[model samples]
Target: MRTDGGAAAVELTVHDEPCRDAAEVIDDGLGTANEAAAPMHEVRALQCYVRSADGQVLGGAVGRTWGLCAELQQLWVAPTHRGQGLGTRLVRAFEQRAIERGCRLGYLETFSFQAPVLYRALGYEVAATIEGYAPGIAKHLMTRVLGGS
Candidate 1:
């Protein structure tokens, strides 16, 4: 390895048991996260992947549930596939699964340049907004009460 800065500022080593070491580190990290999050909610993770008719991978939704709330961590649709309702379907399917898991509310945060309006049309209300979240951007946190009567 090479750097323009001081080599003494960095220390590099190789682990003979890379997999075992990584597994332990992952476990420890999850333990730390769960210690803070588990008590407040039931840990449930979910994902939904979209595929083309001929089996090309597109985009999808991935999120998790905590307590009675579910969050949409990520939602993406291929640029060529956008404006075709794929994003909406993915979100609806994800929320349906969250509902099945007993989540009563659905929430997500997106940049101001993203689909906050689409979410609003789907009944999500703005919960919060952070200005200048990214120089010329803002982050909008939105939430909606889920479940049926």
Candidate 2:
């Protein structure tokens, strides 16, 4: 291939030797095996809830997760039911899941559109603050400590 009227070249090579042995493979695989056995270090999804008794869809919380920490990606509650404590309930529910996962610390970032005050009142401390995260939106980095399971 040629680009911008310049000569172009490409090269490819393949190695013939085996890249890893039994011990190396075992070492690499051990981390996953150990985590599975421990259970707390396992990564998992965030849960959602609805008003089952009334068949009303309330809201949902989504999480982006690492081995032991989960980041709340999105939280939405229907406007008609805003002041009845649904957000607090959802947060507590997510916290339970985090505790079960043996997470010592949970971190999340909220843009200008998010509910920063709610999180702050729930014992989540502001770890870092970023100005203008998205045009007029400030980003708040929050963290909560979860006791080991």
Candidate 3:
């Protein structure tokens, strides 16, 4: 996902059914109400992928932006595929995509059940912490500057 002040390009090396299905289901759930009321789609989404050398899917990340700020909506690496630098690679890829779209900053929220540590290590700083964002989960709001380096 490295950029050289040029147009953004996405490398979708893999596409698995589970992830695509989940995204469709979630989007359907959220978009139903909006569709009934507005009859339009107003949001754009992005998906970045990482693949093994032999063409197997390693992992990927997903995100979206409204304007100058982008929200990293979700990132997932298969349990057996973790710790192979896929997450970091996907992040760098998405960052490049966001920066190319004129994004200046990026942010993401992770719960205690997820990897806030990974986010921190990826140069995202804790912007806010919610004691109980979910029933038993602590939520960390993290942010990073895009194209700063």
Instruction: Name the better of 1 and 3 by lDDT.
Output: 1
Lowest-lDDT window of 10 residues in candidate 3?
9-18
What is the alpha-carbon lDDT of model 3 when measured against the actual structure? 0.83
Clashing pairs in 3: 1-93
lDDT values, one for every candidate? 0.86, 0.75, 0.83
In candidate 1, position 32 carries an lDDT of 88
**Between 1 and 3, whose TM-score is larger?**
1
TM-score of 3: 0.66
TM-score of 1: 0.73
| Candidate 3 local lDDT, 31-127, one digit each (tens) | 8877888635544587898777898776878888767778898999988978888788898899998888888998999997898989888889999
Residue 110 local lDDT, model 3: 91
If candidate 1 were superposed on the true structure by all CA atoms, what would the RMSD be?
A: 7.5
Model 2 C-alpha lDDT per residue in residues 43-141, reported as the tens digit of each score: 567776757477877887778556768788777788888988898888777877877776667777877577888888787888988996567788989
- Residue-wise C-alpha lDDT for candidate 1, range 12-122, written one tens digit per residue: 455666678767998999988988865844568889889999998798999998778899999999999999888888989998999988899999999889888888878
lDDT of 3 at 12: 41
Considering summed lDDT, which 10 consecutive residues are worst modelled in model 2?
A: 1-10
Best model number under TM-score: 1
